[model samples]
Target: MKKIYYIILLNLLTVTFSCSKEDDLEPTDIRYDYFTVSPDANDEESILRRKFYEDHNIHLLFNDTLRHEQRGTYADGTPHWFTELLDLSYDITSTKNETRFTYIRDHQKQKEGIRYAETYILPHLDKELRPYSIFLVETLEEYGWRWNTVAYYNGKRCLALAIQGIAELEEEEIKERCIDIFYNIVDSKTNYYDEELNDFIALGNKLHGETFESAGLSDDPTDEEIYAFGFLTWSTWYQEFPSESSDFTSFLKAVFYQKEEDFKVQYASYPLILQKYDIMKEVVKQKGYIF
Candidate 1:
């Protein structure tokens, strides 16, 4: 029944997605304010009715109230255009969730590729206004879906959209942090990746800074570059800890309702993924996000 509902939902999402394939419809010009919340938006359904009044004089749009968001067209561009990728529904199953879900279950390879490809072929991942600037790519590996390559948790720090190896994470502190980052992106308002996150890469470690510099990038790194850098760097950082997904998020203090932003942003600076890398490593070893 869930699968049936999923199919029906996909069809509906795609129904209106058959818009012009022309390059003329610039993303910045697309009408994202397609819906409006009434004055009576205090109900459970209006939980994510969105504070459209929060519009900024910036290039990116951010919606902090949503429980879930998506980066690609797995849902045929539904809940799109803003940095939050806003979807208020409590249990929306998206491409990211299914991708990570593979780790929860053994590979059902027969279906993953085709489903993933079909999802990827859709007109999601709008580049000009691509969420967090993370783009999509195909995997050279024999298995894994194409759109599954990258994912981002709304409030968690694992902004995995361009990140590889990490499964689709629909969980964590990345959510609130994501909102804060969006606020930053809009408030700061220059080209986001170029100036705002330039220092986010690690410098000396083999995981990120030096590795990114080794990529021969010029001027600044693209969103994909930052995602790759975070994935490689953090993967190595958490490598020594117990190898469970829960444990990994704990070590990084990436769970919900936690004050991990200080820890996250401090490391988010260019020199290393964690400024107090030693501290987090020890904290995880001692108890592991249990406080």
Candidate 2:
């Protein structure tokens, strides 16, 4: 149901079933607001910290930042990450303080591995990809996790960030809308694109329609907006995809990690993934983000 020109990119990247051909719809230079987001984000951690202090710091007795120099950029510079090691001091309980530092120490190594593994691959991932970023585990776990959340940590970092390197209404406005890039959690609903909102918005859908073409509204929907049609799409997934869903996390593991060849079996929703890519690719192009 999402529309046209972007289909060219999806068609080339994915498969015939995954992407349909309706290659006539060209992009408009109208400067639509939703696709206009371009974050010149340099201070990732500081940006997140500020958001926490503003409205999310009520529970922690004490929390602070720690820095360590590493070997990678925030996907900008080719090799160095975490440019400096800042000496941070905090006065929380010993257990809490130790836990926090342990997390930092762990990420110093893990983030480096992630960089090494995906640095080359990301640049080739549809020019609009965001660098891989994960909210510091301490910050996310303490403030945002919903116990055993699946893609919450892995998928967004690998799949979503690659889909959202720079996005935030503003730096101080970083309400960890980081995940919102994956699915626009902030503005998700059951409505269609409200031209009045100056932003592309969506409301819920039953997804009872025969196909993605039928279930979806515009053929040009961003992946986030399509996902805004979550509850229904998720329900239908289990009926067709072999991936059985017990919870959100389980559903994610099944859908994201499933084999592509396997998606065509009995009830697979293969074309949907292709449609998701079309919207994401098109939006990024409109926003002028680099690959």
Please give the CA lDDT of all the candidate structures: 0.33, 0.32
Model 2 error, position 10 (Å) = 69
* Candidate 2, poorest ten consecutive residues by summed lDDT: 56-65
Lowest-sum lDDT 10-residue window in model 1 = 133-142
What are the models' TM-scores? Answer: 0.19, 0.25
**How many pairs of residues collide in each model?**
15, 19
What TM-score does candidate 2 reach? 0.25
For model 1, what is the alpha-carbon lDDT of residue 186?
25
Tell me the tens digit of each residue's lDDT in model 2 across 196-227.
Answer: 31221121223433244555445444445444
Model 1 has an lDDT value of 0.33
Residue-level error in angstroms, candidate 2, position 165:
25
Q: What is the per-residue lDDT of model 1 for residues 77-156, given as tens digits with 9 covering 90 to 100?
A: 56554344333212334332332322211223322322332233212222222233111212211114453333333211
